[model samples]
Target chain A: MQATLIYGAGDVRVENVPDPVLREPTDAIVRVLRACVCGSDLWPYKSRAATEEGERIGHEFLGVVEDAGSQVSGLRRGDVVVAPFVWSDNTCDFCREGLQTSCRHGGLWGANGVDGGQGEAVRVPQADGTLVKLPVEEDSELLPSLLTLSDVYPTGNHCAVTAGVGPGTTVTVIGDGAVGLMAVLSARRLGAERIILMGRHQGRTDLGRDFGATDVVAERGDEGVEHVRQLTGGDGTHAVLECVGTRQAIETAFAVARDGGTVSRVGAPQYDEVPMGFGEFFRNLTLTGGVAPARAYIEELLPAILDGTLEPGRVFDRTVSLEQVPDGYRAMNDRAALKVLIRP
Target chain B: MQATLIYGAGDVRVENVPDPVLREPTDAIVRVLRACVCGSDLWPYKSRAATEEGERIGHEFLGVVEDAGSQVSGLRRGDVVVAPFVWSDNTCDFCREGLQTSCRHGGLWGANGVDGGQGEAVRVPQADGTLVKLPVEEDSELLPSLLTLSDVYPTGNHCAVTAGVGPGTTVTVIGDGAVGLMAVLSARRLGAERIILMGRHQGRTDLGRDFGATDVVAERGDEGVEHVRQLTGGDGTHAVLECVGTRQAIETAFAVARDGGTVSRVGAPQYDEVPMGFGEFFRNLTLTGGVAPARAYIEELLPAILDGTLEPGRVFDRTVSLEQVPDGYRAMNDRAALKVLIRP
Candidate 1:
């Protein structure tokens, strides 16, 4: 089978790999139909030492269950399913609490000898807990949207939900990445009355406007914060969704947050020492949202996707075949594509 | 009138000052009935540069309305009241959102030209918003508890409330000062089933136990974190109330926080940066709570104090007259008193 691997900086490649086999009773074999590159994948693509053998990559996919272990229940062979970015035993205390990312028995994909989603097939451990059966056909038009249930859309919703974005609330989404645009859509779905999207890219911010952003600020640093505050009548937004993990992005998130509002950062933070000391403390702001528990939110969002009220798949501006994953990575990294879908 | 002043670090004194008078339509002159030394006060007492002319120093106090400005309503001269640590216009958006500490027109006591709570008389800005009328007498035995409603007790409640502490939740309170002990009580009131108080002081932890701390871990740093983990089946607690502002205290708070739990820091965090990057982000933990919006909680907590269901005032282990204001500061600074109540 063919899979994606990163040999070093800017070196994403498709290469032959062993077909997956069920290794545990809780495991199942998933032959991926559609997998996609995540913005987070760019972290390693931009830096990290060169490697001789490369490593497995990708953690978002929807697929057909090629095989199921004996202990797997509620799912079977040939059932189309979506797997969250991380594998978890849904019965663990953290999983039960809807914080599956912290599940004691769970682990990240493409790590510790686990199969990555950007491959022809994956051996999914804790299959019953990690995979959500999709009601759509493998080649359904809704495949793109359903694929996002694996990580992206849910992560956007997590940013809004954790920040308590709701009807009549004003929101500020920081970033113009696929996840940021998805957050704009999610906030609108959650009834945010106004959304201020801070981004420099004209194309991506245009997509953000289509998704629900009422205002767009193309500035950076202090200028962006000032623009957001100006658009919000000088009080800033009720919620700030930080989808960019850079220090400046986090700073802008807190800077443009209204007093008593929430700042939810769904992006994988790239820096340490957050500015949550005194200034933010006095404002009564709540800092939350991290590592979206996609498994827990997949069910809650499926109905909307099934009914066609949500079109998060619009985030995918480009699609590629398994052999062109390197091009996909470059396109995304070079800002030529919002997100690249991979048909394996 | 007489008032407490901080001429420099470790130099506190009581001296004659001009009598306070209403300065605005929203102001009122309060004859302080009781004022208490706060853990936050020690910050300025520890390192701030000396001044030739002393600055007013106290923020926690209950008083009688000596006079109300022409535009002030719902308050009259001689009305016994408790002023929140900060003055706020309750009608502001932030105040309406139950975050009065961030009220648009609010300002801290003893800052700028505002009269300090430790003074015999204080000109309270935004009188109607800052003063909560107390039913108890000036010299009532419940005065101690009623005074805590101004700051300490509500600060504790804010820690628990922001962390989402609730039935069956396990809580860890770092620090055993008056506020930490009050947090133990607050967690119990919020129905937390297990409360682990991390502190080394025998007397303070004893008070913490009395305030419903089910367990006490005297170890510091890593040992304390380990002890807390062992006590909670190696998963740590669901809520961590950080009542000490030092970096070490915050480190312990995060160390003993269970994945997906909340860390609420009510202390005046002395550091500029916080460890809220990748490590805490991956755990899906929520970091919240800052300066307490004490005014918003005073009404909610008063009934329990009035009905004898809560006794937060027990934290006041010593008392002093107006002339002994310097001694009060020294006593609290040296850990000779949990809290020092002042009578002028």
Candidate 2:
């Protein structure tokens, strides 16, 4: 089977890999239909040290169940499904609490011998618990939107939900990436009265407007905060979605939130520490959000995509064949594409 | 008039000071009847550099309205009242949202030329908004408990409320100081099913039990976390009240909380930064809390004190006359008393 692998910095390749097989009583073998390069992948692609051997890559995908073990319930072969970014035994207390990312028996894809999602086929553990069955037919045009349910869309929703973005809330989304755009959509869906997108790229900001951003701030740092405050009548927004992991992005999120507002961040934090004293402590602000529990949100978001009410798939502005996965990464890294979808 | 002043580390004195007078159309002068040394005051008391001049001290007090400015309404001379730790106009957007501590025109006691609460009389800005009228008589025995409404009691309530501690939830409070003990009391008042107090002092833990702690973990750091996990059937508590603002206290709050739980901290943070990457970001945990909006909570809690349903003032284990305020500080600093009440 052909799978995507990263040898080191600037080295992504599609190479032959061993085929997946059912390894546990609750396991299912899934044949990959679609996968994509993520913003986080660029972190390693840009700086990971070179090694002679390549490592399996990718953590988001939708596929068809090719085989299912006896213990797997409510899931069977040939069923279209979406795998959350992390696999969890959903029966754990944490999973029951809708925190599958912190499930006691869960593990990330491409780690500890698990097959990466960007592969021809992969073995999924806790099949019934980790995979959400989709009603859509194979090759449905809704695949891209459904695929987003595996990670980014749910992540954006997590940001909005944690920040308490709801009816009449004025929000500031601090990124122009796919997740940030999705947050605008999620916040609007949650009935936010106004949304300000903070991004410099005209193309992405244009898409942000289409996604429900009522205003845009192209400035950075203090200027960006001032711009958001200006857009919010000098009081700053009631909620801020931090989708960029950089220190500046997080700081901007904090600065642009009103005194009693919240800043929910789903970004993979780049800095090791964040100051929570003095200014932050005195503001009565809430700091929430972490890795999104995609499994918990998939069920809630699937219907919107199936009913054509949401078109998150538009984020996948470019598509590539499995063999061109390297080019997909290069394109996204170079800002030539917003997001790249890979059909296996 | 007389006031408590801090000249330097270990140097507290009762000194003559100018009498407070109404300074603004909205101001009022309150003759303080009771004031107490706070846990946070120890931060400077233990290390402040020596200076020839002294600074006014204390922030928790309740008293009789001595005078009112022309514009002051709803408050009359001789009316008993309690001032929140911070004064706000109440009409500001933040105050309207029940975040009076962040009011646009609010100011903290003992800051920005404001008279400290531990004085014979305090000139309270925004008097009509910052002072909550109490029906109790000036000489009523409820004065001590009512005094707590000025700070510690409301601060504890803030911790419980922010952490979402309520019916059937299990909570862990880190610290055994007056505020932490008050948190245990507040958690019980809010109907928490179980409360755990983490502290090394058996004396404080005993008070914690009386205040409503169901369990006490004397261990520190990792052992303390393990102890809490063991008590909660290895799942950890649903809410954590961090009443000590140290790196270890914050870390323990995170470590002992269940996945998707909340850590609400009211302790003035002594550390500048907290690590929020890797472990923190992967868990769906929430960190919320700040300076308690005592004014926002005073009304709701006042009835309980008046009706004898609460006795938070039991935390004031020692009492001193106004001239002995320096001894009051010394007793608390030396751990000879949990807290000291000063009768001015």
Candidate 3:
């Protein structure tokens, strides 16, 4: 089977790899139907994150189960499924408490301890807890939304909810990436009265608008915050969803949120010493964000995707063969595509 | 009238000052019956926070209404009252949402726009909103606890709730000042099963235990966190209330709280950065704290104090005349008194 591997900075390759086989009683072997490049992938690709010489790359996927170990009870062969980026034992105390990403024995896929989903076939650990079986037998058209549910959609949802975005909330979504676009949709679905998408691209910004962004701010930094504040009656947005992990994005989110509002950062923060000041404390702001516990959101989000209430998968602007995975990364990195999906 | 003023760092004097009078339609003059030196007062006295020469200080008090503006309803002249250190209009959306400290028109007593309570008579703005009336006309016996209700007690309660402290929670309280001691009591009142109070002084630590601190870690910095972890089955505490606003205190709170636990800081941070790592994200820890909106907790806390369910004001050790307030600040700053009460 073919899989993507990172050998060093800017070094990505699709090479032949052994077919996945179940090693644990709870493992399930899945033949991926669809997978896509993630913003997080840019961390190692851009050399912002430490990396080994060779590391397996992707984590988001929608696939069909080819085999399941004897202990797997909730899923079986031929089952179409969406696997959250992080695998967890759903029965753990933390998982039951809606913090599946912090499950006692949970592990992140695609980085050490688990196999990457960019491969033709992957082994999923804790299958019963990690995999969400599709209610219908088969629907090829649902792959895009399903793929999004694997990571981005749930991540966006987490950002919105953590920021307390709800009816009558004026939301500001920083970062016009696929996740940020999805956050626009999530915030809208959660009933935000206004959704502001911050971005620089016309194509992606348009898609974000279609997904539910009510406005767009093309500026960056202080100017961007001022733009949002102006849009929100000079009081700043009621909730800010920070999808970009950079310090600048976090600062923008903090600056644009209302005095007592919350800044939910779904962006994987890489910078230390997030610049915050007296203004933040004096106004009482809450900064909550981390890896989205996608598994916790699947149950609610899946129905919406199936019912056509959400169209997050539309973020995929280009599709490529498994052999052309490297090209997809270049196109996304070069700002030519929002998301590039690969069919293995 | 007499008031304590900060002539400069480490220099405080009690001197005769002009008597306070209602200055606005919403203002009320109160004759302080019981006022106390706060942990935050030591900040300026110890030169941690620079003070302007001859600036009036202190904000916690239980007093009798000397006079009321015509617009001040619900409170009458000669009524016994506990004034929240923060003066809010009670009409702002933030105030209505129970975050009165962040009220749109609210101001902190003794800071910037507000007058100080460490005087014979203090003028309270937004009187109807800032003052809570005692059910009985004469309740001098409840003065100590009522005085605490103005700041420390409610502030401690805020820490407990913000940290999500509840039944079966293992809590750690940093700092053994009046507020920290009250936080220990508040944690017990909130049903935290285990509480570790980090303090070195035997007197303060002993008082902390009496106030329901199950364990006392007489260590500082990393050692304090390690001791708390050791006391909590090596997983750190379920919640941490940081009542000391310093880099070390904030870091200690962060280090002591367990994965998925919350660290609530009510120490009025002067200038510091809360250092964080990826571990905070992966472990699902939450950090939330700010100036405690004592007004928000007054209604709930007042009943508790009135019913004898809590006695946070037991922290006060020495009583002095308004003229001896300089000594009160000195004693508390030097750790000679847990709390010092002043009568005007």
Candidate 4:
């Protein structure tokens, strides 16, 4: 089977790899139907997240179960499913609390020895918990929507829900990437009356508007916060979605939220020290949101996707064959594509 | 009138200062019946906070309403009241949301020309919001409790309540000052099953034990977290109360909370940065509480105090006249007192 691997920074390649087999009683082997590149993938591709000789890449996908281990319940051969990026037992205290991303018995998918989805086939551990069975069979048309259920859309939902974005809320979305765009949709679905999307590119901003952003602020730094505040009657937005993992984005989200509002940071922060000031503490602002447990949101969002009530897959600006994932990475890294779906 | 002024680090004196008079339509002049030195006061006394020459100190007090401005309503002369350290209109959006400390029309006491309660006669702005009427007249027996209502006790209550401490929750309390001891009581009042008090001295620990601390961990840093975890089935406490402002205290609080648990930090974080690691973020821990809106909790706890159901005032280990405030600051600064009450 063919899979994608990153030899080093900016060196993504598709090469032959072993077909996945169930190694544990809780595992299920899936024949990949569709997978996609995530914004987070750019981190390892751009940063020095040291890649060994040949490491499996990708964390988002929809697939058809080819085999199931003895202990795997609720999943079987020929079942179509949406796999959460992180695998959890779903019975741990953290998972039961809807914080499966922090599950004591769970770990990140595709990292370590666990196989990832950007391949021809993969073995999913804790199959009963990791796989959300699709009501419909694997079809070409529903691939994009099913693929999104793996990460971006659910992540966006987590950002909106965790930030307490609701009816009449004026939200400021920092970052115009796929997740940020999805957050706009999520906030809209959650009934945010006004959303200001902060981004510089025209294409992404237009998509943001389509996704329910009422306005766009193209500036950066203090100017961006001022723009958001001006649009929010100088009091700033009721909720802020900090989707970009950077000091500037976090600070901008903090500055653009009104006193007592929340900053939901879904971005995977890397730096040792966040540059947020203690002024946020005195202002009674709440900070939360990290590592979205996509599985927690899949059941709730499945109906909307199946019935055409939500079109989150509209974020896929480009699509390619699994062999061309390297090209997809370059296109996305260069801002040529919002999201790239790969057909296996 | 006499006021306590800090001329520099370790230099405090009780001297003659200008008598406070109502300066605004919403102001009220209070003849302070009781005031107290706070743990935060020792920050500047210990040369931790930036200080200027001859600045009046203290922000907590109970007093008799000596005079009221034209617009002051619901309050009359001779009425005994406990004033929240944060003066808010109590009608703004933030206030309505129970974050009066960040009220749009609110201002903090004891900073930049704001006359504080360390003086015999102190002027309180936004009197309608800051002053909580005491059912009883100003009596010596109620002095300690009423004085605590202004800051520490209510702050601790806010921390415990905000952290969702309840019958099954295991609460770990950081800091053993007046507020920390008060938090031990607050957690007990909220029905926390296990109250782990982390502190040093025998005096404060004994008080903590009396206040319902089920266990005491005298160690600091990682060892303290290990101690708490060991007591909590090796998963850390379900709730943590951080009442000390330093970075170390905040870090300890974070380290001692279980995954999916909350850390309610009423501590006035003075440091520029709180170093959080990947472990903290991935654990799904929630952090709430800061510059506690004591006004929000005062009404709920006031009756308990007046009826003698809650004895948070037991935290006051010493009392002195307003003229001896210098000695009070010195005693608290030298750790000779768990808390010091000043009678004006």
The TM-score between candidate 3 and the true structure equals 0.95
Per lDDT, the best of the predicted structures is 1
* TM-scores for the candidates: 0.98, 0.97, 0.95, 0.96
DockQ score of the complex predicted as candidate 1? 0.86
Fraction of native contacts (fnat) of each candidate: 0.92, 0.86, 0.32, 0.49
Which DockQ value does candidate 4 get?
A: 0.55
Candidate 1: tens digits of C-alpha lDDT, residues A252-285: 9999999888899999999977888788888877
Error of 1 at A15 (Å): 1.6
- Please provide, for model 1 over B190-212, each residue's C-alpha lDDT reduced to its tens digit, 9 standing for 90 to 100: 99999999988899999899899
Give candidates' CA RMSD values in order: 1.2, 1.6, 2.1, 2.1
Docking category of candidate 4: medium
**Model 1, residue B334: C-alpha shift (Å):** 0.7
Clash pairs, candidate 4, are: none
Model 3, C-alpha of A146: deviation from truth (Å): 0.7
- After superposition, which runs of candidate 3 have C-alpha atoms over 4 Å from their true positions? A48-53, A137-139, B48-53, B111-114, B137-139
Candidate 2 collision pairs? none
Interface RMSD of each: 0.9, 1.1, 2.1, 2.0
DockQ, ranked from best to worst: 1, 2, 4, 3
Docking class of 1: high
Write the residue-wise lDDT of candidate 3 on A69-177 in tens digits: 9999988799998899999999987788788887888897767657888879899999999999986655578788788989999999998987788899989999899
Shift of residue A98 alpha carbon in model 2, Å: 0.7
